[model samples]
Target: MRETIQKVGGRLAGMVIPNIGAFIAWGLITALVIPPGWLAELGIIGAETADTLTGNLVGPMLKYLLPVLIAYTGGKMVHGHRGGVLGAIAVFGVIGGAAFELSSGAAGDPPQFLGAMVIGPLAGWVMKQIDDFLEPRTPAGFEMLYNNFSQGFAGLGLTFVGYWVIGPVMSAVATAFGNMVEGITDAGLLPLADIPIEVGKVLFLNNAINHGVLTPLGTAEVAEAGKSIYFMLESNPGPGLGLLLAYWFAGSGLAKLSAPGAAIVHFFGGIHEVYFPYVLMNPVMIVAMWAGGISADIVFVATDAGLVGPPAPGSIFAYLPLLPSGGGAAGVLIGIAVGAAASFFVGSILLRMFPVKDMKDTDADADIGDALEHIPGISTV
Candidate 1:
């Protein structure tokens, strides 16, 4: 079972290699060059001067095109037209759904219709199958279309379709997910993210020591911002959001070690001491992290709250200032408190629900059914 699942997972990851590559390219561009220049070009921002800088075209081009292009090309490489065309449509639906929410007041359309979005891939699939009648003798009824790069043209065409026909179909689906997170986190998610900090400052030696002290001192290089793997994975407040919340508010397994560990790692360290392996010794920790991370991310983004401090290693030291500064000196501390409580609330619930073994019993059964059974969460989408 493990062997079979690995094979399938590998194949799924293989399909979205283009997007992964694009992300790497994006990192390099952001590090070596400028960051926001590209986003402004695609109307993702209102920066009128974006054309002169890398911000205008680079970010927008990649953001809009890269994802679908990756989906279509990857789908084509592995699963042929139906997979390529339809998969590309699906990718647009997810990202576009997010963007649509961000950008409202267009064509007099409502924001959250699921069927509007689902129809893009449906139409693309229909176009793909139509070949059966059009050219049954040839591959999918047409050699030229298949032989040529159908991924882009087909995907681009489907993108147009997604705008008109598909977005409405999937609006409900996207809205439901959004509403679900809003319902779950309330204001508690903010405080939960604070736990990792306390753990790191006391126990882990902290990010100040790691990112500021050790990383800079050790390396001759400047350690470009937002591009490094250290920045990419461990940069966000995602990892420890749950456990800290659990420790502080609900006191789920509220030992000194657990809460303090979350504090030291999350607060001062910004380290991903994802005690999953340890927690997975039982099982529920697996579910806890997944549900916890998702809620935390959604809440942080939705609330418009973010870390203003340097996220080099992503500790409370860096993340604190971005929160609403009401008490002047205690602003960061206040935000941390809110984030920590929320995380604990969500984490405790999830941990109790989805326990898994630390050993290799195979997450394929558990992880696969998430959306696509085989592909990776990061690589594919």
Candidate 2:
């Protein structure tokens, strides 16, 4: 079961890692150009410039480009370039279906990322199966005709399925998940959310959860509240920082030696993925993450802390500009501090009790990247 989960996670990570650059570009553009963003707030760009860039670049990239990229990657994973092309073609139907649903008065405009992930691989597999059956039956002079027509027809059917079925289903699923989170917040049990979130982050569902689920809900909340705690839930760097700090101080050999660099990336650079391998290496350390996340969320609820926008990359630097002014800023800082301290204390104890065992026959001086390659289902990206 663990191996299976890791394989699934590795695939998911595979699709997203290649696209991290695009996500970062979109995030940076949004953070710098949106109203209350860094450039506008700093008086470096006027409101008009910010608005134009946002309207022309940010919204389309989020709505169209990102999901298509994900679908293309996923399809490529299943059946090479042909599968990728089909996947990209099919995802348009999903996007259109979602837009149609929204036009009927849906409360939120959730990005079709989840829909893309589902349809991309499905489209690839369908094309692969079609080729497997059709190739053997095609006549000697009809190879090109068989190949082109098979994929074209399959893509057309898949697109219709995506529009009529997959899109509506995925949108409903997104809505349901959002409503569930909203219910938790309404009941004053937002911290309880960390149970699934911390566990999911380690399993490499962090991006799917954050971008597919949380961001849409958080965006809706921001429309009413000017900020939303939903953005902080998965992206908070405190727990990962504390975990890496514990590893730095208490772990052994390669894991210990690599901790400081990973901590810097996870906390300051806002690449939270750098710390996931540590948790993967030491599954028990997830408890420390849970403790940290829940503890921080408690503070967030008490202080009503939130950011003006989602902090992409989730680094301390990404967080700085998004921080609300005055007490909210202090609250965000305090919560992060508390989370880190709590995670560090608990993680330290766990490492002392269950230190990461060095791999048998591995060199003591092996490079961290080389050592990571030996771990099953770990992605160093």
Candidate 3:
């Protein structure tokens, strides 16, 4: 069951990972162009310029460009170029249907990422199956006609299916998920979400959860509110930083020697995966991670902290540009600090109680690299 989940999660991660650049571009633009965004807040751009960019770039990119790119990538994953084309075609129907549904009085205008994830692969698979059946039966002289017409017909039918079926279904799913998050937030239980998130990061499902799940949900929240706590939920670098600091101060041998560099990368660079090996070497350290994540999240909720866009690398630098205007910056920094401190404190205790005995440098490095390679779209030099 674990293997099955990982495989599915890996595929989903694959679809999103390739398009991270697009996500980052959109994020950067949103951060700079929205009212009171960095540019306007800093007096670099006037309100008129900010408003113009928001309408021309931010709104359209979030609503159209991102989802289409996701669908195209997902379709390509299933059945190559042909599948990708159909997937792109089908996603438009989902986008249109969703727009129509939301215009009727829905409170928020959520992106159709969920619909794209579903229909892109579905359209691709359907196209592949059609090609498989038709290829064997086609006569030698009319291959082009058969290939072209079959895909055209399939795309047409799939677009309708996307509009009438998948779009509404996925929209409902997104809304349900959104409501669940809101309920958790309302009850002040948002910190509890860190448990699964911290565990998943250790298991190499970090990208799947952050990019595939949290990002879409966060984007929806951003549509309603200027910023979203959902964006900070999984991407916060504090817990990982705390864990590495513990290893640096409390660990022995290579683990100790390596901890400083790892901490630097994990915290400032925002590549949280660097610390996973430390936790895996001593699973007890996960308790520390949970403690840190939960502590920081509590502070986040209390302060009403959020980011205007998803921080792609989960780094401190990536976060700076997205900080909401006003007093949100203080809350964001405090939460990160709290998380790091808590994790470090707990992680130190865990290391003292259960030390990672020294292993050969090559063995430790290989083990870490091998573990990382199991995650989708990651490879170590």
Candidate 4:
């Protein structure tokens, strides 16, 4: 069971890890377009242009670019370029608006990204299976046409299946997940909610939790409330930042060397993956992360610290623009400070108990392609 989970997580992480830049780009655009944000408040551009950028430009970027890129990556990981094309084609159905009805009677438009993750691999695997069967049967000169058209037709068929079938299933699941989170928030149990989030993250499930579940819910809340703490709940960098900073100052060898860069990227660039390897190197640090995460949630909940919009990449700079005007800015700052402090304090203690040791390269530190290379017939090329 453990190996199965790790394998699945590895595959899912592979899909999102390479696309971190797209997430950052979306964050930049989101920060500029939202009112009272960097571009709007700085007076660098008029409101109309910002709105146009958000609607005409940024909207498509998120709807098409990120999801297709994720699909492409997953497909490529499974069966190379042919799988990639089919995966991207299948994702169009999920991106299409009002194409299906949800179980709750809601019209499903702009399907959850979780659906993209599922359909992409499915399309890719199907293509791979077909390719395996056709390899020996195809005539030499007709190979190109046979392969291309087969994938093209398969992609087309999967697109419709994705739209009418997978989209609805994801909708119901996402809706249920959103309702659970909202219920916890309504009951003031958000701090406790951090436990599962922190655990899932360290287990290589961050993409599923963030893009799959939180993105849909956060986007909805932003549209309605102008801001949501839900976005901050899982994406806050404070906990991870604290751990990395502690590792930098009081650690040894590779961990110490990598800690500073990881902290910078996580806090400023909003690339959370930079810190994952650190935690995976020493699982005990997860307790520190959980401590910091819960503390941050406490402060955020107590002060009602909320952003005016979702911070897509969760960078400090990206986070700033989304803060609601007035007291919200201060609350956010304080919450992060407390969170980081708690994490650092706890993480430092852990470091002292089990000092970082010099170690040779191993699967724990290897990239997905390298780590999975042992599996037969599954070429990452």
Candidate 5:
């Protein structure tokens, strides 16, 4: 069990750039940190139906559309054009479809059972087979297949199946998921007073990188980068209370680091770096990061911290540019100070207990490609 956990942890860490990003994004949306605002109100449509309906739409856009794109692009890069195309198709089918089903609930745009789940896998398999057949025939390389009419037909045919036939089904499923959250809200299972702080935490629309201060200068102006669906989630949290709870229990080690400086980063700052490297190295550290994330998510949900605005990465320094800046700014500063300190202490203790050995160049072949083997799925073969 320990070995299995270690392996899974390592894999999770390894998949960070592509798959993990999507998973984290998915978690954010699930936590309702990036929920569509109207959803909450729609429940009250009889009470505030218009608002809830609006929120439901936002949920699918963030949860389904964004993550599916990330996952598809990532998978495509890993596999190739074929891999990329199928990856998009599959992610759209499963994750997106699920989101729609969950959000809408009732008979909606696309019927669920008949489409995304079935068509998605079928498209993915066909794409994979096509890729396999086109594998580099020459001892040295794979020639360009862009001009191949037969391959093009095969690829597009699969796409036609997915987009026209399967698209709406997936959308409905995602909307249905949104509907469930609404149901909970309507039942008074979620309180209104807690909304501000709870929703404020997840900002379900924001992305992790944006929360980390990596936004390029003028990028927001030029491309509206800061306003991106992912970026918005980074700035605004979904009610991540449930997720935070899961991580707290399952990832205690990682969670303990939410100390003064570190805590601030993951919590208010939403940087998440505190446990990143640690988790990557030890793998078990993920147990903690995941726990912290899940717990924070749950709290976010409960607090109704969901707010909109460019939640500048939480820090007294970064808080300068935000609106109604003073109180939030102060809160940001205090949280960072406390969180970082707490994290330092926890990290220190863990280091003492389980010393991580420094990484070494042990590959027989020093070429970077050789390093790829250590990671899973460098090549599907």
Candidate 6:
């Protein structure tokens, strides 16, 4: 079971890790549309800027483009480009199915990220099955036509299933998950929940937790609450940021050299995967992350704070636009600061116990994913 979860987690992480640029784009667009930002503060804001950018670009990217990207990545992961195309087609159905919500009082259209996770791989697997069946019986030289049409029709069929069934069902599942979290919050148990969440993340389940659980819950909450800390709970870079910063100064050898770059990417680029290698380098760092997570959770609970929207990429800059006004913003800012401080202090202490020396065989490139080598087109990046 443990190994299975890791494999699944690794695959999901693989899909998202390659598309960090899309997250960055969404983050920037979100930041631009918010009130009282640099643009507004600088008096460059226009009445229609937010609506134009959001309606024309950000909304579609989040609602449509991102799911397809994820589906494509998942499909490509399983069976190559054909799988990718079919995966995106299947995901389109989920997105379409989600167009009508069964529940009232939702803030807006439901996010279909989880739907992407399901249908993308499903489409890939289906395509792979078709290939296995066709490869044995097809005549010579006509394989292209046979393969294209087989998968094409299969993709068309899956899209309808996605639209009519998978999408709406997944939307409900997302809503139920959100309600569960909200119930926890209402019961004052959200802070306690972070321990397991942090543990799961450090164990390579970060993508599953973020996209699978938090994003869905956060999306549903955003419809009614105007924001949710659920998104920030696991996505915050503070823990990783603090750990990397500690390594930057306290470590030696190749680790010392890599920590700075990893810190830059983890903190600003909003790609948490950069720091996974660092944590994996020293499993002890997981403790530091847990401490940070707990501290941040407590702070959020105390402040009764949340984001105006989910922070894509979950970087500090990406988080800024989503920060709620007044007390919520202050609480979030303070929580992050406190979390970083706690993590830095703890992580620095842990580093002392496991002082960095010459790089191990794998430690030479301690912060990069080895899994990338296996994925197509990943080498170029």
Evaluate model 1: give its TM-score: 0.40
What is the per-residue lDDT of model 1 for residues 301-365, given as tens digits with 9 covering 90 to 100?
44444332234335554444333343222433343444445546666665455332211234542
Clashing pairs in 3: none
TM-score of 5: 0.39
| Candidate 4 lDDT over residue span 197-253, tens digit each | 776565434544565455666677768867677778888989989999989877775
**Model 1 worst lDDT window (10 residues):** 225-234
Badly placed stretches (over 4 Å) of model 6 are 34-37, 99-104, 188-190, 193-237, 240-266, 269-291, 300-334, 341-381
TM-scores for all candidates: the values are: 0.40, 0.72, 0.63, 0.72, 0.39, 0.67
The digit string of per-residue lDDT tens for model 3 on 114-183 reads 6777788888899899989989999999999997899899889988998888877765654444444445
Q: 129 in model 6: Cα distance from truth in Å? A: 1.8
Question: Can you tell me which runs of candidate 3 are displaced by over 4 Å?
Answer: 99-106, 188-190, 193-293, 300-331, 340-381
C-alpha local distance difference test of each model: 0.39, 0.75, 0.74, 0.70, 0.36, 0.70
Ranking according to lDDT, highest score first: 2, 3, 4, 6, 1, 5
Q: How far is candidate 1 from the true structure (C-alpha RMSD, Å)?
A: 13.8
- Candidate 2 — number of clashing residue pairs? 1
Q: Candidate 1 — which residues are off by over 4 angstroms?
A: 1-18, 31-54, 77-99, 102-128, 137-160, 169-286, 290-306, 309-381
| Tens digits of per-residue lDDT for model 2, 30-102 | 7677666678888999999989988898889877898899899878878989898999999999988863222
Q: How many backbone clashes does candidate 5 have?
A: 114
Quote the RMSD, in angstroms, for model 2.
Answer: 6.3
